[model samples]
Target: MTAGTRGEMDEAPQQLPGWAIPPSEGFTAADLDRLPVPAHTQLIDGGLVFRSPQSAFHTCASYLIVEGLRRHLPGHLRVRREMSVILGLRQRPEPDVCVIRAEADRAPDQTAYEASDVLLVVEVVSPDSEERDRKRKPQLYAEAGIAHFWRIENQSGRPTVYVYELDPATTSYALTGIHHDRLKLSVPFEIDIDLTEIDAL
Candidate 1:
């Protein structure tokens, strides 16, 4: 008989990732921390939403917006890109770009921000994220009491910004402006961005 004939192999089942089998209720925002690697993921209403690969237009548009905000940022505010905001226990979504209070700080180890810290949230609508950007996300952000949201759409390679502001009485966003070519604003602060810059990008 072979020496190993009497031995039985280990039968213990290996554990799986949180996403491999989500809980009955769905994943909590905190569960995102336990992912095996830094994933391009977001949690929406306890669901793990994986990101699709970004297109070139998505990259350029986001970059230009961030640069514009940084160049004109006031002393009390700062800009961040692709960072998750903790909107609720089960709601954590990454805005493509955000303007946050400076007090949130830039700690190298900070993984998330409280929704209250964000002054404005910007979503550069990817083809895959259009519905969320246009509907669900704005609802979540509004309910979280965030005051401003912008959705950017690519119109024949041009960036058109649809801006919204929170209505205090209803706690929902109201259409504030639809800007093309140049986006200038005054509510959050004095600002102007040449939307046409994407043509050169």
Candidate 2:
């Protein structure tokens, strides 16, 4: 793997779980745009990721934050779900949610979105994704110099939102705050979203 100016690590060969099959090799960004819409589908680092259909609870929680961000964020910020984020060389991941600075060329065919363009990324934790969302993905984001990252854990009866901001000194993210009540995410956006609405979902 070629490291960019950011000092990225080589992607270690991953051992897939029994249920997680290896992705087709040589998959490119164009292939991602052409894939048929499937239930609970996403692209991880250019490989297809398929999850079981989201439970009613999961859908509600996901929709809650997605809609809230759309409704409240500043007009100069863009909010999207399942949008492919092009990580140079190593991968392109479709995070559960992403907030980016507004751009004139917001097209599906765009091959890359630089780290400087991204403002925040959010992932909703599922049983199968705990290790990745909690341990692995954050490291990748930090190395890419993404400014903010959040992991929303709802594996239990109640949900928790873990908020993190990048720490430049260590090239890692630092926990800013975690909230189980009404959440106020004031970042690239000028508005506040009450995550309690997510529980309603």
Candidate 3:
């Protein structure tokens, strides 16, 4: 289904007609490749979770953040969007934006990035995905040992960024800062951004 299409996430039948039998051993990353699902769907904890269409604000904010990171981040890191990150045998989540070590070995046509290669993962909170982005994803990313996480939310109708750094001893994130107008961060890399400028783009 195309973006902005409603009803793409309707519940699937327990059993299908053709060779699409539900696996008894639970879903895996490989299963996502074989199954026919909406393009925005993610495989989370052995279930197919479909994301609703992104709003204009969501898309614009994601683009601006990626552009900001690319301009400021060092050459040794690569920024990407909507790429599936394999966190475990059964958990492969697609973050809105992600940064990874540039030198990490990857085939020319790798479909999913290994979690170990990821340096940071960013999720842009939507009305439908607030719970997953705020709670569920942080827990999963921490478990996968991803060093950094960022959550973007709308604050009074403007984009705001919340930054986090993983504390290894606890394997949980500590809030680093919350940005509204200006965002200057030192961890993961130093970058200063004007939040208002992001939306202007």
Off by over 4 Å in 1: 1-19
Top lDDT model: 1
> Residue 134's C-alpha lDDT in candidate 2?
94
Q: Tens digits of per-residue lDDT for model 1 on 89-146? A: 8999999999999999768888889998999999999999999999999999999999
Report the number of clashing residue pairs per model. Answer: 0, 1, 0
- Top-TM-score structure, candidate number: 1
RMSD of 3: 6.5
lDDT of 3 by residue, 1-201 (tens): 755464556656567544344467668977777778767568778777887988888888899889889889998999999989999988998999999998664777776888999999999999999889999989999999999999999876578899999999999999998899887888789988778975566
> What is the alpha-carbon lDDT of model 1 when measured against the actual structure?
0.89
- RMSD per candidate (Å) reads 6.5, 12.2, 6.5
TM-score of 3: 0.87
Cα deviation at 151, candidate 1, in Å, is: 0.3
Kindly list the per-residue Cα lDDT of model 2 for residues 1-201, writing each as its tens digit.
446733555556678554344345645545554555454455556566666656665667778778878888777888777665766554566678888888924676664466678888888887787777898778888888889898888845555778899999998999988877667766645546676665555
